[model samples]
Target chain A: MLMIIRLMIAAMFILTTPWSGLAEVQDESALDIQVREIAKTLRCTVCQTENIWESGAPLAQQMRGVVRDRLKLGHSPEDIKEYFLSRYGDYIMMQPPAHGVNWLLWLGPFILLLGGGLLLYKEVIGWVRRTPANPTAPPPPLDEQARQRLERELES
Target chain B: MNKGTQLTLVLVLLGLFYLFYEGLWGNPRHIPTVLIGTDAPMVEGPDVETGEIISLEQFKGKVVLLNFWASWCYECKVEHESVLELHRLFKDNPNFVMLGVNYQDKLPDAQQYLKEYGTTFAHMRDLKGQLAIDYGVYGVPETFVIDQQGKIRYKYVGPVTGHMYTKITQEIIAPLLKGQPVSTAS
Candidate 1:
């Protein structure tokens, strides 16, 4: 009877235990989500073109750790980005801030496109003006001898 | 095309060529650092050989030259001798302290490298690379010169040899040691 009671108690304990620990292992915390969001914005300085989140470089991993730590400490994403910017300059950011000389980098291509389009448009219009249209005069009233030869060839 | 249009096209082509040349041939290592003139981050790490904690905080009010190096980096190997020489030159001064930062290298390998190359200064191990990140270091052999007031006055991201060696010793570190302001001209 004691063995049966012990077995029943074990069964009850197993049934009553919460699965929250398993869930915690599977799910990322809110702080982790914040770290991911911030890490995705930073460039891996040691890497050619990878963001810190996607890079497997040790530096990138440390940077992700930094983001997680800062997020845990209540630093906002903007503050974190500013911190990296202050450290590594504009190069650390995946997107260069639109300021000063960076504005030229941002807008130079569009300005070039507009100017090139205008120049091409003007040149095309000039070509149209300079190019002579097809001669519209009636074909010299096709010579009578040529007309008779054409008709004879058609009949043959 | 009209004169104005032709001239504009020529200028645009010239600008594009200049940009292309710069994009292809420019020195990629010359990344401008924002840490210049900013307060140096107080960092600490373990001594590579001794495992004792070495904190930059204790070196406050002294000129600290932090050289980040790794055993595997070729440039670090190239600059090792010059680095030791620089330390020797300034080590006599009570206010000057030079610390080598062992970055992203294995313990045995780092110690072996030191044993092979020889070292005159204490090297702190950046175990998790947090100390390097604190100083905004990305590559090996990067060096920083901190002023007496704890502000980072200069940073160089390559081997310290030849002109760079002379420039750092005479121009940057000497002037700062003398309590004169150094130019931020990289």
Candidate 2:
């Protein structure tokens, strides 16, 4: 009976170990997903054209750690983002906030595109209007008499 | 296009080009800091050598020079001597305090660096880098001058050496210590 009881206890321990490991992994992955989501939005201050999530720079790593800690602390994603924004200003964000002078950055390209398209369209329309409809009818396709005269002139 | 429209178009294009040029080539170090005149974040960390807690709150009503650096950073090594000298120069002032922040460095390596390069001021280890983020630090070798009222008066990114050393000592810190207003321009 003691041997049977001991075997049962050992079996229970073995069975529970994998379940505990799985639980820990699931918890970590949930936290990791949150960290990645937040880190993706922050620009790596030390690296150009890379967000903190993708940057290998130590600073970016630290920023990711900060995001994870804040998330663990029950701070919302917006709060974490706001914390970074307040610290590093608009530059810290991957997408600059559409306010203040940053409005120019957000809208400048589209405004330029619209204005350029309008100008190009106007110029194209003007060119179409200025062009003769049939290009003077190709100079009346060179009448037979004109063709003969041209040939005679060339021969002379 | 009419003359007025053409002129406007040229002017807009020129403006856009200028902005693009500045964005591409401008020094990231010169990117203006928004922390100026704002309350400095009160932070704390363990001292690198002593393992004792060093809190910035204790230094309230004093001018604090917070220099963030790391062992792996080249510029930090370059400015090490100048940094120590800056501390020596201002250490005599009762109202002046300087603290070194060891950022993103390993414990053994940090201690080894300090042993070789030497440090006069107390350096606190940025354990999880929370201290650095709280201060809005972009990278190592960045310095900040917090006034008596805990307002960050000035911030400079990069090695505080040569002309910068002179500027911080004379133009910024000196004036602030003398109860005179200093320029917040980076």
Candidate 3:
């Protein structure tokens, strides 16, 4: 009867004990965070626009696995990225490489904005220089007869 | 604008137009392979049916034809017969080897696929998809041909049928087997 009672107490304790599984899941390791960070940078080659982190395609999943495996093997994130780049070229990068003609893509918008701003500034300054000191030109210093006619008209 | 500035502007406009043209019309699927002149990845995996290990290392100094396929892929089903035919045409060549890589597939289903489709070559299981990633595979139905020196010479994505079959056999594999430099279009 004592042994049975001890066994029942053990079962209750076991049932009440919390499993660490939930905590384990909630606490994503540094490696997992690194994997997510790297995955976000890689373009899912099969998918047109989605990055590997956002893509549900099998290839994207496989790429993630590759990233994890490489990480475990002591390859740095840059090395892993370089490996992908060597295999798939610049297309594998979410933002294409900034070498060769691709520099234009990076600088094009700012260049256009600066150019447009300069053009507008030049036009505004030119208009300012071309305009007379007073916009109304002081009525050309109204001739005496013209002034008298304007006075008579006003009186009438 | 001065002459130099006008010329620069025209050139810039042309460049922009070219980029737009490439972005809108070029085939996104056609990623210019960086693997084609590089050393083929020395990959190893289990034989899908027999559970035996197979490695690219064992087939050193031979023309290796690696095909990546999955059971769920339809294009693989499309190229099944031609794959067998390609194997048959070149199997007698002592320097030629054909290997199929079962990617992202269950063992039983992959086995069933081989049985259903009729396989003439040994197929290896990609355990964790490392092999596929090592080969830089984007999707299934990709074929790669490695020269005797273990350099990947050609890679093609999609079903290896129709004109592709002829091209592989005649232009790619035939030349490689003869130790002639591959001068034809890949």
RMSD per model, one decimal: 6.7, 5.0, 8.2
Candidate 1 lDDT over B40-123, as tens digits, reads 999899999899999999999999999999999999999998999999899999999999999999999999999999998899
DockQ of 3: 0.30
Local accuracy of candidate 2 as per-residue lDDT tens digits, B65-175 = 999999999999999999999999999999999999999899999999999999888999998888888888878889999999999999999999999999999998999
Pairs that collide in candidate 3 are none
Q: Write the per-residue lDDT of candidate 3 for residues B111-154, one digit (tens) a residue.
A: 99999888888999998878987888888889999999999999
Better of 1 and 2 by TM-score: 1
Q: Which numbered prediction scores highest in TM-score against the true structure?
A: 1
The CAPRI quality class of candidate 3 comes to acceptable
Q: What is the DockQ of each candidate?
A: 0.33, 0.40, 0.30
lDDT of each: 0.87, 0.89, 0.87
Give the TM-score of chain A, superposed on the true chain A, for all candidates in the order listed.
0.63, 0.77, 0.56
TM-scores for every predicted model? 0.83, 0.81, 0.74
TM-score, structure 1 vs. true? 0.83
Give candidate 3's error at residue A154 in angstroms. 45
True contacts kept of 3: 0.54
Candidate 2 is graded, for docking, as acceptable
